[model samples]
Target chain A: MKEFETVTVFDLLIRYIKDGRIRLDRTRFEGLATYHDPCNYGRRAQKRFGHGFFEEPRWILDQCLENWVDLHPCRENQICCGGGGGALTSGYNEERIYYGRRKMEQIHASGARMMVVPCHSCHGQFNNIKAKYGLPDLSVKYLWELVADCLVWP
Target chain B: MTPENSLRISIENLERTRCAQWPHAQDNCLTCAMCSGACPVAGVDDFDPRKIVRLISMGMTDAAADSRWPWICTMCGKCEQICPMGIEIPDIIRRLRAMRARDKVPGILQDGLANALRTGNNLGLPKEDFVFILEDVAAEIAEEPGFEEFTVPIDKEGAALLTTIHNKLVNTHTDDLKHWWKIFHAAGEDWTVASDNWEGTSWGYFTGDDEAMRVMAGRIVENMRRLKIKTLLWPE
Candidate 1:
């Protein structure tokens, strides 16, 4: 276990950008964007892994998009997208959407048309709520999707 | 007193579960409701993080374990994060979830976890289909002007990075795989994906089965050893 290091995609993206292995096209993505902190990567990681990924995603977003905002109570205090803990596949559809009320409110309040999430669970939940809550204007993208879209080839 | 107004608590229930793993003891909670306030699903099915702690501390461990609240909770750790007493609400909830029999676990989660244990992926997608999807997706990416001749290097040894795919990306969202592949190609990073036991999400963690969680995670380590991969990019 000690021979190999386990890192997240965020770390890889950061390293690639820093080393100039990849350059981002900032103009690729438009519209007001905001981030949703996945609890495991944020609060839980802080307690268990000793270092939370609070700033990594934001730093990557900074390079990819020109306009982005932070969700209220981001990082440690961010609200759950309510699709976590395997709830997306837990067969609690109505209750899951109900649980995401606060998250819906947060996105509405942030006025961000695009919400970038780093976790699959959060991405699934945000997509579910965005449709269930009738927020067609809002679209969800994975952090990697943003990076991929903004990649400047050659 | 009416039966509805009065209830009995059993110390034996609490004592049995007292030694279970939780970072902090339930006795430390002050019923401050901070956890409840921070919890997004606090009121769902009459569940709240504070109530779970209170029930466990009051010798109502059975009541706490039997309720649907733990399952309802997303285990997002917001309650634990905001707890003034620093009680591990998520840990306690996970323990509560573990108390139930495996058959009693919610259906979708239970079935998915079982499939993951039996097969390499949660959806139990066959290796042939997995490879077929990868090659097909790569073909699509290659069709794009810049990514001609792109191919997925499966189970290649001595690669610098090994990435695990989220099952959904292969099952329903095959196109999404291109996003990361594009980056890897552009950066010229040496990465390979395992052709077997390559699941990214650990359903055992969600279902509160520690042993299963260990087995699932062990497969990843085994992959690293077999493939001689130096780094893992786990996006799950």
Candidate 2:
């Protein structure tokens, strides 16, 4: 719930930024951002009123930056970091690393310093995946958390 | 073997279960530890995913079935993703949860799961009430300054895709409800939340009872059929 709200909050905030009605100093980010789709959310999003997920946090990032950047291998088919489905609990520790190594490669490929995750499961999974697999350092935060942090504080 | 011996064998087999053996296990295959490392609950303090499976294989279910760790496992299958032996640890954890749900419900979590089975939602919230709350939430979203005309679909047939959210997403995290709502609008996509069977979180899957899981799946399928939605994008 907190996870989804992160996205929602991001959306609302972005809308406020672009609303053009609320005047403020706008400084768009000149960096790339990537989104990670959690399977649980994917499991439920497959057929709700004939829709598919594409621009998750990407959409919000787009609202904030013209160069939101591109993650070569985007959502849906994105590699599993081997942490969800109770896998992070320890039944297959060594195997989790083996599988997560693939995801580590992807984040390395993205070359983005920041990865936006809107799902709680994905947040924990990525952090653990990077540490476990020794992937290159990259900042990770909930999509909303990022937006929340960049509120252009008054 | 004599007939008496055969009878003894029959009784032992009858009493045999996944929980009946534990003391005999010396250690696990080094590769099998992947299951434990991949498990989400491993970091949750003493809840070793591999240990749970070891207990299951050894038939040490009494302690496992009673452990609160079963409820904590999200059944995400990361262990299976990395398992070299191809062991379906998530399935094992699911079965354990189901077996335990029968003996005990744990707390409001089980109650919510039961309510979902009985009333099509974790809270057993009435359909009318659910619809009312959904509209109310959406209304609030619309009134939030720039969200004046935000539209969240409800039973809109022939939508290209169906986006899903956990009931907990809307009921508890109302603000979060707008995350996807805003996504849908930004994409210029067509979607709707089902008036019936819209709850996407499958607690039945967690409970380990296949019957309940199927029931939950059946509801979602039926809802899809009703809405004529072809794809389901689940947001757990």
Candidate 3:
């Protein structure tokens, strides 16, 4: 065993892109897009781990897409998708969706047709919000999935 | 004019509820409503982050703990992020959530946490099915033009990185797994996953069950030690 260092897929993605190990096509995705910051990895991670990863994700998104915009308040100040802290499975789903109204508002205000989330819970919650809020055109994706789609394998 | 009506707070209860983890959680409050404005669930059930702090500072810790407000909150840290005093509101809320009885925890979260402890995954998915899904999905990835024979490495000893799976990836979003696998294939990364205890999400952390969280996290460490893998990619 080596030093036993722990890293998130986000960290690895950043490394792979920067190192040119994984090549991406910026025009892979069309239309405006936005990024949703999961609480644990964004604010909590920054406060506890000393690096919250706000810019790394945006940097990754920038690699794969051209027409992307950030939500009204992103990074540490970004709104949670309202499905974290077990709210998705807590059986308080109605309340959870209600709480996500702020997120929906941000998405609507951003005029983004696609939203990328790094956390699994946020991914699921945003999908549900999309259905409930009648944003049928709104596309939700995992940050890695977006990168995966943009990969230019040689 | 003297104050017509003022309620006295229980100093004893406030002292009892005070914990070392967040010493100034309530002490240095400027009563700014930034937290409430930042919180997504502030208005639900008449919930207010400021009110929760007021309760804790007033020695109504038990009330705050037992109230539906804390459970309603997703512990998103937005309030703490915007707080001028830099109060650890989420930490305090987690402490209060821990004080709740085990059975009293939100039902789905409680059950999922128990399942992860007993079966090494939140959904209690058996090892056989998990492996089958991995192989099946890998086969699909293999059909792609570049990847001729993609095989998922499970419990491969001495691998450089060990990635855990979020249960939903196996249960509902199996296609999502391919995204990472393709990336791994392109990056030529030597990563392996554990056959047992491969779940990445921690429901224990969600339900404020620190003991359960420790157990779940320990299982991953156990896998690392067993496999001799140095790096862990805990994406959840």
Query: Which candidate ranks first by TM-score, i.e. highest?
Result: 1
Clashes, model 3: 0
Q: Return the TM-score for each candidate structure.
A: 0.95, 0.57, 0.93
Off by over 4 Å in 1: B1-6, B10-17, B20-26
B8, model 2: CA deviation in Å? 15
Worst 10 residues of 1 chain B by lDDT: B1-10
Tens digit per residue, CA lDDT, model 3, A2-87: 55898777789998988889999998778899998888888898998898988888888888898988887888888888988888
Over the stretch B72-103, how does candidate 1's per-residue lDDT look in tens digits?
Answer: 99899988777888788888888888888888
Q: What is the per-residue lDDT of model 2 for residues B73-152, given as tens digits with 9 covering 90 to 100?
A: 65555566567765656556666666673637544446666777888887676878877877887887777655677766
Task: Provide the clashing-pair count of each candidate structure.
Answer: 0, 70, 0
* Fnat per candidate: 0.86, 0.11, 0.83
lDDT of 3: 0.85
Runs of candidate 2 with Cα error greater than 4 angstroms are: A1-115, A120-154, B1-46, B72-84, B101-103, B141-149, B157-161
Every candidate's lDDT: 0.86, 0.59, 0.85
Q: Which stretches of candidate 3 lie over 4 Å from their true place?
A: B1-9, B12-21, B24-27
- Top model by lDDT, which number? 1
Ranking by DockQ: 1, 3, 2
- Second chain TM-score per prediction? 0.91, 0.71, 0.89
